[model samples]
Target: MPPSSAQARADTADELVTALDSLESLTSTDPERALASATEVEHRANLIGREDLTMRAQLVRGYALDRLGEVSSGGRIAHEVNRWATEHGHQALLARSHLQLSWFFNMIGDTPAQLEHALRGLECLDEHAPARIRADHLQTLAGALITNGSHEEARTRFQMAEDLAMQGGDVHLQIKVLNNRAFGEYVAGNAQAAMDTADRMLALAATHDFPLEITALDTVASAQMALGRHAEAERTLLSAAERSVGSRGANGEPEAQILLTLAETQRLLGATDRARTTLVRCMDACEEGGLAGVRVGALREQAELLAMEGNYRDAYELHKVFHAESEALVSAERDARARTLQAVFETDEARRESLRFREMSMRDPLTGLYNRRFVDERLDAMLGEWTASGSPFSIALVDLDHFKQVNDAFSHAMGDEVLKKVAEILTSAVTEPAFAARLGGEEFLLVMPDTSRQEAVFCCEAVGLLLRSHDWSTLIGEISITASFGVTSATASRGSRSALLAEADRNLYAAKRAGRDRAISDPTSER
Candidate 1:
């Protein structure tokens, strides 16, 4: 006998609710059961031609598939849902579908697709949704933009999302948006700003009772680690990890991000064994949850830890996989950048050619001196070489005394000539094969490849005297300039690049303190 219409409608609604409840439960603790429930719902919904029910069922199924590491298949389903929602004028559903699809693409390292979906979701929300949906969409879009290397724009979007969320009284969304903005700031080399933002988010998270609180604390810890606040990072991460253990069975992205933060903080604190163990645990959690992207991130962190511990063979094998992932992400970013530049330049070939020239122009035009970009690249290479060769090098930081006074007394053009002359004089003073770079303004760096403390000191002193002795022909009269030099030699046992720079800067300050035209060398300090 056929079922009555009222009974059929009731049955369908009851079944959908049951499936959704089961799926939500499994999303945190048992994905297999959730997947089974989702599959049944999907079948029933399709038979009944209920679009909303079908979409919800598909969403749950896609999420389960993603957890099971079937990312491509899951992403296809998400895309289909997104397209269907758009075609049917389901604005809210369409926005959510695009947001989920963006995350799906991000899992596979398809940054362009991620950004496209995020932007589309944002557009949908702006055009037809409420403030809450708009804020959520903006947060997702900001995260995608940050991942794709659009730091400045991502920051603005994140801020706007946070403000909107706060105005709408959505503390959860505000915390999430703040965390997203902090990550962008960290990557953009603004560690202090990142730390500040993370602290604010953590405080806000604490006032709210939500799962996102744990995630926000983890972000705070990561920011603290980046800013060299290791003790604070350890404390924050420990608290987050402890809270997260209760929810570890969940297959949520936040859990993975928190675990990765804990592992990274451990690694930064030189607890290599602990870090490796934590990373392995994170990988296990990711696999269990069927979170493929998180698993990939855990793998990359494990590889880095192995590399740090001198397990190069194992690290290299892991890095091979990491390289493949990185290349995919980089290719997407390059394509996006290319498109953006093409819009600016009009011609594709011209844009490509201009990018090539811009890369080469990273070096200083005057004095044939390496610029800041070259210095950063060379420092990385130098560290690698030193690790292999066990050779010592010395770095001398030179600053001209009262440089602004020279420009004020003479014409600005003449000041440029004086700087050029000073560069030439310094270059001529160093007899050994060394690297000289202009570090912006009147600051310069000279790196002696294989020099001892005494030799480096002598070379720096000679350069200081050369600058003091050079006479500049100005319209008013001939003038002489003096420079202060600080010399710090690199040792095989030095901590890091930043440490070396700090030591050299300290000695340079000492030189200036002693006198305006003197050289200071500190060979006893091993900083």
Candidate 2:
């Protein structure tokens, strides 16, 4: 006999496994080539009808897409693959799929989805899952946690990842985890600790790993910036950005972030013209590379610089554009979360877990309002409904006036009380088809569906007046609690959710400029 069919199938599977192994080496080195190779593997696996091979190929392909700045596309692929793996009852595939999805969201600045998906992946990992996969999941989850302001838990996760990576003898995984740990330290405001960690990491990666070294340098620059060493930060960031030149995903992403920081440092050093040039360069790079997060940063920096240059009108318009882009980024992340949820909610166990996770993730832990993630998703959905049904909707961006003074006079604890009190007011005020959410510190997004701009303004004015008149002395020792509101309605002029939110943000900025403790719906209206 020439060959048995079973033997031939076994040989083919071996070849595919080897191919997958080889392709992974190209991920940091040559992501474009890795993407092409992954496509080939997927094609062959589909023709062979090998579910295992298909899942493996898809995992790598999704990773490559994310690396190439196609995060949304990669997330969709990961979601579909996860659904297939679940249907096939392949536990290892399921874990890998979740891991890939987690990476996609992480790349796009979606920390909540990153943490949730990473946890799901870790939960699915069994003995059959690779040690490397387990380590990666732990590292990513730790990073997401750190970004979400969970320092202690993130440190614990980072330690676990470090231990796992050490046990597996994977230098790459160890270096990646170390970089994240350094960044975590920086985020915790420990500039000295972060610098020390990054220095050690730089030494470790100096000889063998260009990508890791670049990341370490970025960390060092961040710590320097935190420590108020603008000149040192600028020099370090310039070096990192220069070295990042040929490393598409590995270095390109950091280069963008580094450039933005470099520009900020330049601005702080009073090199206004130079800062503008650097920001322009950053914007161009981000646009060409499709780095949405980086682009938003560039826009914000440029707008700030414009304002500093006494170009108030241009700065305001630029800030409006920045707000629009930022909203789009948030919307993209929400869509990614929706895809992950769709893949997960296929079984009773998964459905229950998802419900619990959403309850935790969607609400701001401090204020009990819907978080920015929820706000973005809801805004996008409402915009779509408004477009389709000719229904009216409006948004108000509410920001507390002189709130920092209260925090300084009392404490953040008292400040938290104030926020909670405001949250309570907004929650109580909102009725059916209307909701409120905390956008971030000292800011809230109030949305009203099926309501005109005029009606929305009325509600916002009432809230603003209520806040101005609220008896905050009982909680924070006689501090005034006033808020400024910006109101905008869905209109043909605002084509997208981002545009609509941007309009509201512009109006809000106008309200603050005129005077605090007021609501402004019309941009042209005199104060």
Candidate 3:
């Protein structure tokens, strides 16, 4: 007798569960294959119409996408899973989802959101949670806490994570924790502690012969650099760069970061020409790999190199430019308070929670600004609004030039502070009818309702001035900020959201190419 349809469906579910496990396992080492597998699994799960299978598949798929460097899309899917799991009482998935969101925020340099999600992830875990998951959660939470400047709590969490990893015999996880812990100690300005941790991690890696990547080496090099052991750091970084290139290929962020450190060491060693050449190569790698964080360092190194050559005039000008670029990292604490006020001002429990969730879903948790999802959905509606009222609607895509360096040179805490400050500036810049949103990364959006194209351009110009003139020194010493604006209007292209954004993006890049810290509007438009 043939198996019943119910039996077949049950068997398929069992098979999908197995597939999900395998898919998750392979994601880091084989993201492309994992992504392909995830796509198939998602399709099959959807066809089955089983929430259990569908959610699990999407979680793995999101993880795969994150591993593959599709952070934004991966985060969106993970966020969906988070919402679903929260509403459906799927505790485990909810925790994992939070972890995914934390990682996503980390990638985008959204430290506040990363910390928030990391905390939430840990809170969601229960006694029954798997040892590996618990260990990872602890490690993530510790890293977030360290980034946020909570050293005592971070140390406790780190110890717990370390113990869990050791007890579980997870050599790799233990190494990851050590790498992060060492970096965190360095960021905390504890060179000795960082060096000690790095040594322990190296010793462990050597004993096990784990194919650990160069993050630990980079931390050790950084510690050596901090201690003024330039020659030692140079040698270490050179070895790391060579090994990383051989194992992970050239032109990746890790390798680029290592090259950046190498260049800095070379500069310190008085190899000005070699430093310049390495800086050039590092900049190229950064550009190719979109390593904005490392690119900041490369730019600053340019200023240093110019100074080394006794080109004071060019060096001073370049230093000014470098600091201007660094201004993008500013005050996240204020963003949090604003979000809290928003939540508190909402009506009754149910309505308040609903509004909170709605806002959270639409807003980028890091900046407390409307996210891309909100932009995508709201732009069409705003287009309709302008179409109906016969008024004007304008938007400008603002990108922070050399913003990633804030996180790279200084600690992420400083970077978080900088990002928040920028959001605050943008918030203050916009009026009631005009609001700002963070589109992702270091990009922001300004939407002006009932405003003409000319008006929007003028507003953007003022914002540029505000950003440039603002006292960024209070946040990151001797730094200033500037952004490139690509402004567009409904009158120009009301057909679709993508069309409007594409034009603005084009003009934005034009401004970037033309020289940054300026706003540009479409000159061809019939105003």
Candidate 4:
């Protein structure tokens, strides 16, 4: 070839490499940048009549679109790239395109498409691709397999990725592999193992100053929460949230997740108001980020709060909305799975169905508020989800004043009537989307998912007034009931869910000490 021709070819090749690097960088952090770079490369390749460069550009653009949440457009671009690459015998580019397609399917939660593309990518690699790229491809495959509930296969793939990453001396790839392995461990209920892996990854990422270290911190928090180490979990989550908040755009999701966790811890501590405030922040962040999954979670927490506040009708409505959104996401995945299997069953579908059944069982027979078991289970789940999402929610421990005196003054039948009437009055008075459950013996627990401290106090006061005013008919004459409420909210100072609960319970006793019909709010002491 002439010198001029050779220089032109070299320039074209350099442009193609630059486009690929830019696209890869954008894949993790900025989809818009990736799309712009890929488009520029595509234009240049077309001008130069370089078919291979054009194919690569098309694949990069498709991957960018997929990350931007434009599934259909990205899929079409991937199809075009596949066609061109196959026609041009560019097997490496074709393999990468397939890998991108697999990731797209995974993002949309489409099991069948994810498996198909992943398998195709593996076949094309055929033991010849660079170790780092092959390891990445395997990691993706492991994630897809894990999501589809193939735990054993996922583990093997993750292990293979780890081995390859270590062999290639790729710290970033190794971190990713460890993170995925931790997820697999979590799904398999090996909480301790998961935590260990997450801790290692977080340490590595932090030491290396990895930009994506937040992900490892998030995983560690999740594992800690699952293990019931609420204090450690909250601390980890808050640190992650702080890091996320300090970062650029769309960083609020991690903060929201952490706030949700703090809320749950507060709720467990009996700081109903504090939990509510945390949840409100979490919902707001999710809304700002346009994170549909997080939004659904926030709504579900809101419904739980409403239920705790005795607004069963509204709670039921909100629950329906939450269930619908969750089902829609699952249905989309199911449709994609159905395309390849005779039948595809999701573990979550069965688990959620069972949960609904259990929820019904936990409802009080007469009052419809949650029973003690329900209260415990709901609190646990709320705390776990909040920790993962980093949002705040709160709880209140309430008790009817002088209940024994009322029962003694009237016949047992009349006492039963009194309890029923009191429950009804409470149900009607505090009708926010927060949750309320009867804890037996005139004690009640209320959960405020997304309410602030002020709002929670207002709610408690409202409930108190309604109870004091409710007319109770007895053989002696008409009477009234009174209740004392203790409220607390989530805070960095509170060590764990139990400590938060203890603090709130102490405050509740303080209210009782001051008088039977008052409310008290306080944060956990500095012990």
lDDT of 1 by residue, 403-509 (tens): 88876787554666777888888778665558778876688988777777778888888887777666665532655688888888776555356766778888899
| Candidate 3 local lDDT, 327-439, one digit each (tens) | 64223434543443333233354366446555666776557788788899988888877777887778899998888777567756576677778899899988886789987
Candidate 4 versus truth, CA RMSD in Å, comes to 24.2
- Stretches of candidate 2 off by over 4 Å are 1-3, 46-49, 107-110, 207-216, 246-255, 270-273, 286-296, 303-357, 360-527
What is the lDDT of every predicted structure here? 0.73, 0.80, 0.80, 0.73
TM-scores for every candidate against the unseen true structure: 0.49, 0.59, 0.59, 0.57
TM-score of 2: 0.59
Off by over 4 Å in 4: 246-262, 265-271, 289-292, 305-527
Record all residue pairs in model 2 with backbone atoms less than 3 Å apart, i.e. clashing.
Answer: none
Clashing pairs in 1: 67-290
Q: Assess candidate 1 and give its TM-score to the true structure.
A: 0.49
Q: Which of the two, 1 or 2, has more lDDT?
A: 2
Clash counts for the predictions, in order: 1, 0, 9, 45
